[model samples]
Target chain A: MSEPPARRRLGPALLAVGWLVLLLPPFYLSAFWLQTGLFAMAAVIAAIGLNLLVGTAGQLSLGHAFFLAVGAYGYTWLAGSPAADEGLSGLRLPPAVAFVAAVLLTGVAGALFSPVSGRLRAMYLGVATLALVFVGQHILLNATSVTGGFNGRSVPPLTVFGFVFGDTDDGLTVFDVPFGGLERLWYLGLLLVAVASLLARNLLRGRPGRALGALRDSETAAAVMGVHPARYRAAAFTVSSMYAGAAGALLALVFQRIVPDYFSLGLSMSFLAMVVIGGLGSVGGAAAGAVFVTVLPQLLGHFADRIPLVVAPGSTGTGLDASDAADFLYGAALVLTLVFAPDGLAGLLRRLRLPRPRLRAATPQTSAVGEPAVGDTLKEQTL
Target chain B: MSAGIDVPELRVHDVTVRFAGLTALDGVSFTVAPGSIHALVGPNGAGKSTTFNVLSGVYRVASGSVRFGDAELTALAPHRIAALGIARTFQNIVLTRGTVADNLMLGRHTLTRAGFLTSALRLPHVRGEQRAHRERVREIADFTGLGARFDTPVSLLSYGERKRVELARALCMEPKLLLLDEPVAGLNTAERAAMARTVASVRDALGLSVLIVEHDMGLVMRMSDEVTVLDFGRRISGGTPQQVQRDPAVIAAYLGGATDAPVGEETR
Candidate 1:
C-alpha cells in the first residue's frame, strides 16, 4: 500500500523546511536569538535523553541535573589549564578529548547509580534521584580545587584542530557577519543535536525498545519473556546520562562559565516539564518541548512590557518576571496536557493529520503512510 | 534444530511453599514426561497458580527441589529458567505494551545477540538478526491464528485474541517445556475449542512437554495424557485422566461436588 499523492509530497516538503531552519539560523538571526537557539538545542538533547529514561523505560529520574553538572564540571576540569596561583587544578587536555571524556564520565556516574536506580521504581526512584542534586551541590561547593567552590569556574573554549569556537587571533567572516563564538558554536550545536536525535530514534525503534516497553508494562511478564529488568534499566539510565552529559557540555560552551547554582532541583523539574509538555516517548515531541521550555522565557523577556501581568526581571511589583512567567505558563501547560491532551503538543499535531515519516509501520496491515488507529485503544488502556 | 527434539523432563519433588504461616503448596510432587501433555486440575483456590509459579521460577519453594532434566530450577531466576528452555504464560494476560508483533519478538530476546548499542547504531548484523527474528514471530503468529492481528497493539485485541497473543509469545521462545496457567479460563465455547486445538498442534509440531493447570474438566480429560488432581494445596490423586476421574479421593475433593458424574460412570 502506498501513501496518497498529497501525503507523498508532504513528507519531503516538511523535511526540507526543517533542514532549512537548521541550516539558515545563523545567517538571518541576531546574536541574542542565535544564543537562545543554542540554549534550546542543548535543552532538546537533554530532554530527548530524559524522555528515553522516563517516557520509554518507565523509570523516573530527578537527578538529570546532577548528570548535567557532572558533564559541565567534567569538561571544565579536564580541559581547563592548571592555575597554581588560583589554587585550581586541571589536566590541561585538548578540548575535543575533554568533551568526549566528560560525556563518558557522566555515563560512568550513571552506571554507578544503577544499584539504586535498578532497585527503586516510580516515585521512590524520583525521590532517590532528588537526593543526587543535593549531593552534587555539596560536592561542587566543597571541591574548590576542581569546581572553584561556590564561585564556579570559567569554561575553556572548545577548539578542534586549529579552528576555535570563539573570537580568536584570526576570526572568519561570512556574508559580512563576523563568525564569533555563537555563530561557530551554532554549527557545533546543530551537529550534536542531529547525532543525538539519530541515536535516540534508532534505539527507540529497535529490539531493545520493544524489550523495554514490555518491561514497563509488566515486570513478571517481561521476565517470562526473557527481559532482565535490572540490566535494561541500568543500561537505559547510563545512555540517558551520557546524553545529558553531551547537552551539559554544550550548555557550558554557550554560557562560558559554570556555576553550582545552575544545576539544582528546579532545573531537573523544568527538564521533566519539557518532556511532559512535548509528549512522552516521542523524540520529536521531546525536542519540541525542549524548544518551548528554553525559548519561552527569552520571548517573554523580549516582549515583557507588552505582555500583560509580566514585568521586567529586576523591576517587579506583584507582576511576574520573565523566568517566573515562563514557569507558571509551563506548570499550567503540564496540568492541562495531562488532563485534556495527554499526548501533549505532538499528539495535537498528529490529530490535525499532519504528514509524518513512517519509519516503522505502527499497524500490521497498514501501509507505510497509514494513520495509526491505535490511539483510542491507548486511551482506554491508560484510563 | 533436532537437538531440542529430545524434550527435557521436569520433576517436582516434594515441593512445599509457605507464605506468612499459610501453606500455599503442601508437598506437591509431579513429573512431566518428554513430549507429553500433563494436566493439573483443581478447584479455584487449590494452589494451581502457586504450583505453576514455583515451576516457572516465579516463587521459591520452602522445601524440596525442582529439576528440569538434572539442572535445578528452584534457585534460578525466572529469566534464567526461561533461558534453560522453560517458558510460561501468565493467567491474567501479561502482554507487552506494544503491537502483537513487538510482543512476540520479545519472546526471542534471549536468542538475539544484538544489544542496545548495536541496535542503536543499526549495525549490519543487527538488521539481519531483526529480520530473522521477525520471520519467526510471523510464523508463530500464523500458527496461533493471529496473523491478521500482527500489527495491532495487544490492548486493542479481544479477550480471546489476547489469549492467543500470550500463547503465541510463549511459543516464540521455542521452549522445550511449556507451562500454561489456566489456558482456557475465560474463553467462550468456540474459543476454548480453538485454544485446545492450538495447544495440541503446538505440542505435536514442536515435540515438547507441556504442563498445564486448567479447570475445564472436559478439555483436561480430552487433551491430557496424564492428570494430577489437587485439593487445598495437596495432591488428591495422580494417574491417567480416566483413572483420576474414577478415583474416590479425587471425586470427593473436587469432581464429585463440582460435576454431575456418578461414582463408577464416565462424565466426559
Candidate 2:
C-alpha cells in the first residue's frame, strides 16, 4: 500500500534537520567534543561497512580491525616522506591519492581473503577471519621499518590541493572561530560519513541489496533466482574492507598517531558491538550504533569525576574507572538491546513511528463479530 | 503478457542421484515438452523433490544428464541454470525477510545488471533499469493476484498468498521453464483450487513449460498435461493423467500394493 502523503513528506524534512545538526557541531563544540564527533563519524563509516557484510550478506567477519589497520598504515606509508636514516620507507605520494589508494589496498587485502570468506558461512567465516587479527598484530609489531615497532609513528597531516588539514600558525577563521586541524578534519569526517551513508543506502535499496538479502535468507533460493552466492559474498567482503579502510584513514587523521596495540581483537569486537547495537542490515542503524558505541566511552571519560561510582582513569579511588564503567554499560546495553529490542535502534525507531498499519488497515474490513475470525486467520497464517 | 519468449524443451535421461549410501533418485527418466504442464507425482520420499533439486542444480546426479534446450543443465551451476531461463520455488516457503516487492525483485536478479559499483553510485541507467524491471514485476504480481499485496511484507501474508508469492517470484524471472515443489501442499481446498487455476493459466498465458512436484493427485490429474509417477526413486508410470490413474503400477504404488483400491481414494 502507498504511504500517506504526510508520512512520505516527513522523511526528507527529518533528514534535512539531521544534516543541519551534524554540520553545526564543529563551529561551536570544544576540541574534546569535535574529536569525539570525528571518531564517531569514522566509526559510523566502518559500522555501515560491517553491517553490509554481517547484516546484509550474512557473512561474519572479526577481521574488520585488521582491515582498518591496513587502511591506516597503508595511507601513512603511501603519503609519508621516505626517511632513510629512520629506516621507514614510503611512496611519498600526495595525501588525497594515498587516501584513495589505501582504501583500494584494503579492498585488495579483503579480496585476498575471499577464497576463505566466500566458501565459509556465518560463524565459520568469523572463526577464519579471527586469524587475520593475530597475523596483522604480528606484522604490525615486527615490521619495524614500516610500523616503528613498539613506538608508533606520527601521522602525516592530510593535505588536499595544498590546503593543509593540520594547524597553521595563522589559521583560517569560519564564523568568527578559528578552524584548526580538528575543526578542519571535522568537515572532512562529515563529508566522508555523508558519502559513505549515501553510497551504502543506495546499494542497500538497489538490486545487489535484494540479492544479498535473499542470500542471507536462503542460499538455495538465491541460487535458483540467479544470485551467485560465493561471488556476492566476496564482493561484500571487499566492499566492507574498503569502508573499514576509509574509516581507518580518517581515524589516523584524527588521532595524529598510529599504534599497533589499538588494532587488536578488542577493537574488532567493538566494531561488532557497534553493528549489533545499531541493528543489522540497516545503514541508519549502523550509524546510530557507531555513534553510541564510539561516543559513550569518551563521554564517560569526559564526565567521569562528576558521575556517581565512576572515577577518572589512573586515580586511586575505589570506584569504577571510566573505561571499565563504559565497558560494563556497553555489556548491559548489548544484553538489553538483544533481549528487548532485537532489531536494534533502527527497528525500535521504526516501531515507535509506525504502529502496525497493516492490522489497522485490516480492522475496517470486517464487523465486530468477524474481527476475531480475521485475527484468528492472521494468527494461523503467521504460524 | 509474456509474449515473444522462447520456451525450451527439458530432457532428463536416466538421472541417478545418491546421498551417501541412500539412492535418492535412481535412473529416473522424463521429458517435459515446451509450453506444457508436466507433473511429477508420487508417495512420500518418492524422489520427486530430489529430481527437482537435480534439475535446478542443487544436487549433482551420480549418472546421466539433464538437457535444457542446447545447454547441459547437469554441468552448470545453479545460478547458471537459472540464467538459462529456469526458475523454481521450494516446498517450504523460502522467502526473504522483506516486502513482496523485494522478494519479487530478487527474481529479476538475472535480468538486471547493476553491480555493487553502479548500484552504490546509483548511475542514471541503473535507476532506469530498476524502474523498468519494477514495472514488469508489478505486472507479474498483478497477473498472479498479488497486485494489492505488492508492497506488503511476505511475513504478513497468508499461507496461500505466500505460495502465490513464490509462484509470482519465479514468474518474475520470465523463465521458459518453472519448477514448483509442492506449490499447494499445505493450502486449504479453496486455496488449492485457486493455485491450480493459476498454474494452468501460467502455461496458457505465458507459453512456458512447468515441472511441478506435488502430492495432491486430484489437482495433478486435473491440471497436468502429462504425469510421471515415481516410486522408490524410480519412474513407475508415465503418461496422461487418465492413463496413469488406471495403471495398476500407479495404483499399487499409491495404495501400498492394493491393486483393487482405486487411486481416486488417495486424492487428498
Candidate 3:
C-alpha cells in the first residue's frame, strides 16, 4: 500500500511555508518596517550559529560576535581597498564571488582559531571567547592598515553587476510606489534567514546531528560509541563562527560601514538574549526572539516620544517614564517567561500545542530533568 | 591451535594508576585474547574500575603502557582509544541526549566522514551516509531487543531497557574488543538472565573480544570463559570461572571485603 499522503507531505509542506513566510513579506512592508525586519533576519542568522555551538554541542562561546566582526571587517577591507578586496580594485568582480570569499575566509579563521577551545568546555571556554572580543576590539582599533583602525572602514557599496545594491541601488517602482535600500534588503534578509534555517534543519536532523547530541550527553559514552567529541565540538564552533561572520557582513552591507562598537560585547549579549528568549537550539524560537527584541524597542521608543501628557502638578516631564516602563516590561517578560518556561518561547508553544508528555512514567528510572530527553538516562550511566 | 580467536589483541603491561598518593592500580598486567570473554573480578576497591578507566583512556596511567595491536594507547585521548576499535559500556549507562536510534548512531560517528557543514547543507553524500547508518543502527538495536522502540527517547525506557540501549550503542561501534563493566548490576533474576543472554549473543554475533568486570559471582561464572580475580589492588588468581570461584583469596575477597559501592552520582 502507498504511504498516507499526510505522512509523506508534512515535512515538505512545513519547509515550503517556512520559506514563503520569510521571503514574501518584503512587498508588503514599508521602508522603515522593512529595515527592522532585515535587521532581525540578520540576527537570526548569527543566533543559529551560536545555537549550534552553545545549545547543541554544549560548548559555551561568548565571543561569537568576534567572528562577525572578522567577517564585517574582512569584507569591508576587501571591498574598500585595492589590495585587500580583490573585487573593488577597479576590476570589480561579481558581488556573489565577494560574498562567497567573505564567508569562506571567515570559516577558515574560525576553524584555525577554534583549537583554543578544543580542550576547554563550559564556563572556561566562554571566558576565553570573551577575551577574544576585548582583544578583537584592539585589533579593530589599532590595525589602521586593515580595519581603518577605530575610525573603522567604509565598505564599498554592494553592487550586483552594475545594479548598485546599497544606498545607490536604483529605486524600485512597485505598483507605482518607489522602494529602495531598506525594502530591497528586506527580501535579501528574508532569503538569508531562509538559507540559515534550512542549513540548521538538515544538520540537526541526521547522523552528525545525533553525534553532536551524544557529545553533549557524555564524553565517555560518545567516545565508546566511536564519536570524537572534541573534533565535532570544534567543527560546530567553526560553523557557528561562520554564521556569525555572514551576519556581520550583512550588517556591514546594511550600514555601508563596519564599526568596532557595532560588534561589541553588548551585541554579543544581545544575541544571547535573543537565543535565550527564543529557546536554545530552536530555529523558530531564534527568529521569534530576534523579531521581538529588534521590533519592541523601536515601537516603544516611538510611542513614548509621541505621547504628550504628564501626571504631575509641579514637575515638567518627558515621556521618559513611558520608555522606562517598556524597558521594565521587556525585563519582566524575560524573567516571567524564563522562570515558568525555561525552554524559552518555542518550548512554551510546544507545551501549549501538545499534551504534557507522559514523562512521569519514565522519569524515576533516571535523573533526566536537567536535559530534555535521553541525556538524563545516559547521564545516569556516566555517573 | 592457539585456543583463543585470531584477531588484533590488547596488551596491558605493568600499568599502575595513582591518585593523591594512593595507588588505585599497582603494577597490573594482563592480555585480552581476541574474541575471548575475559572476566576481571575483584573486591570493591581492588582497582578493577580504575584499570577499565585507564584502558578506556578516561584515566591516564601513571606508569607502564597499553598496546592495542601494537599502537601505544598511553597519552592518547579517550576518543582515540575508542577509534582504535576498543569500545566499552560503563557500569552506569550514559545514553546521550536523544532516542535509542540516535544513541546507537553516535557509535558510527568515527566511521562516518561527513562533517557539520555537510550535514547542515543536507549534501547528497551526507544524506546517503545518514541513511546507511540508520539501517546499521536498526540492526544493532534488533540484536539488543531495542528494535520496537527505536523512535522512543531513551529517557522513557526502563533501566534494563536503557542498559540494553547502551549495549546497542557500543555494538554500533563494531569494536574489536568489548569492555563491559558490571553489565548486569542491580538487575532482577529474570533481567539478569536476559542481560547474560544479550552478552553472549553480542559476543558471538559481532565476533568481538569481551572483557567483563562483574561482582555477581553466579553471573560472572556463567558468562566468562576465563577469569582473572583481583583483590586489594593485586591479582589473586587466574583460571576458569570454576577455579577462580574456588580460589581462597577470591572467596575471602567476596565473603568479607566492602563489595558494596553505592552507585554514586553519574557523569553527564
* Clash counts for the predictions, in order: 1, 0, 9
lDDT of 1 by residue, A113-199 (tens): 999888787678899999999999999999999998898999999999968986675758898878889999999999999899899
The residue-by-residue lDDT of candidate 3 on B1-268, one tens digit each, is 0123345877888888899999888888888877888999877898899888888888898898998887888878888888888888888777765677777788887788887667777789987888988898897777677887788767667777777776777788778888899887866566677788888877776677899998777777777888887777777778887776666666667667444322111111
lDDT tens per residue, model 2, B152-254? 8666677677788899999999999999999988877766777888888888888999999988887888889999999999999999988999999988888
Ten-residue segment with the worst summed lDDT in candidate 3 chain A?
Answer: A374-383
Q: What residue pairs are clashing in model 1?
A: A364-B151
Writing each residue's lDDT as its tens digit, candidate 3 over A62-152 gives 8977888987877776566455542223224455566667777788878886677677876788888898899889888887777776667
Runs with alpha carbons beyond 4 Å of true place in candidate 1? A1-13, A316-318, A351-383, B1-4, B255-268
Which residue pairs clash in candidate 3?
A78-A85, A225-B107, A378-B94, A378-B95, A381-B92, A381-B93, A382-B267, A383-B266, A383-B267
| Residue-level lDDT for B110 in candidate 1 | 82
Task: Name model 2 segments beyond 4 Å from true.
Answer: A356-383, B265-267
In model 2, what lDDT does residue A106 have? 99
For model 2, what is the alpha-carbon lDDT of residue A48? 98
DockQ of each: 0.39, 0.50, 0.41
**TM for chain B in all models?**
0.94, 0.97, 0.91
